[model samples]
Target: MAVDKDTVAGIAKLARIKVDDAEQEALTKELSNILGWIDELGELDTEGVQPMTSVVEVQHSLRKDVIKDGDRQDDILKNAPESKQGYFVVPRVVE
Candidate 1:
């Protein structure tokens, strides 16, 4: 986890980040510490723990699927600027 300035620069180049020389030292130390922390986490004991996707359990309340005719064609066409034969009339797209 001991990241040097050269390693930091190489990492920045690989990640397509433009890290200046002044900031590289700070970034190197920060990234190295983060990796070290992740390494420290590997020492934790959780052999019997069940893997959970989320901390809170959620229940989705859903209504029964019912099918019905949504009859609103005439009502909808009433507000149109131009409608003919139960359809909206628009200018022809092709000549």
Candidate 2:
């Protein structure tokens, strides 16, 4: 993929990056090389390859779902700087 100066400038503008005139040329070449590498990778053939999350298989420990309200209102309110009636008190914002 050939990336021109105008294309690089457009990309920089869209990404909110300020690239100086001299740096823009270098950035355009670097970006083109990176895209070329990606294009080269697309040519490789990989058939029947299973996608893996990790190199080694791992079993995630999961707890059984049990219904409970974990209602420790007083405990939760203890950490609050200002609490009222088992709830954190915040300044009224309604106008």
Candidate 3:
């Protein structure tokens, strides 16, 4: 796709960026080159290539699922300035 100066200016406006008149021409050429490279990539042939997560063969080390409380009730409540039976006491702001 060919990118013109006007197109670059419009893109800059949509992105809320200020592009000088001299800079727009350079940006237009750079965008055109990027699009040309993308077009070239589209011409590659791939008959039966499967999608893969990693290029190298390696398995991720995973641990078994274990659930437990990280903190004790007494330890957590000790830091509170005012703690009730088993919770923190805070002033009510709403009526």
* Alpha-carbon lDDT, every model: 0.89, 0.88, 0.90
* Candidate 1 local lDDT, residue 27: 91
Greater-lDDT candidate between 2 and 3: 3
Ranking 1 against 2 by TM-score, winner: 2
Query: Which candidate comes out best when scored by TM-score?
Result: 2
State each model's C-alpha RMSD to the native.
12.7, 8.7, 11.0
lDDT tens readout by residue for model 1, 1-95: 67889999998999999999889989988998988888876788989988888787888689878877578899999999999999999999889
Global CA lDDT computed for model 1: 0.89
Model 2 quality (TM-score): 0.45
Scanning candidate 2 in windows of ten residues, the lowest lDDT window is 41-50
Assess candidate 1 and give its TM-score to the true structure. 0.43
Q: Encode model 3's per-residue lDDT on 1-95: one tens digit a residue.
A: 87899999999999999999989989999999998888876678866977787989988899878875576889999899999999999999788
lDDT of 2 by residue, 1-95 (tens): 87999999999999999999999999989999999888886677778877677987788789889977777887888889999877788999787
Q: What is the lDDT of residue 18 in candidate 1?
A: 98
Error of 1 at 51 (Å): 12
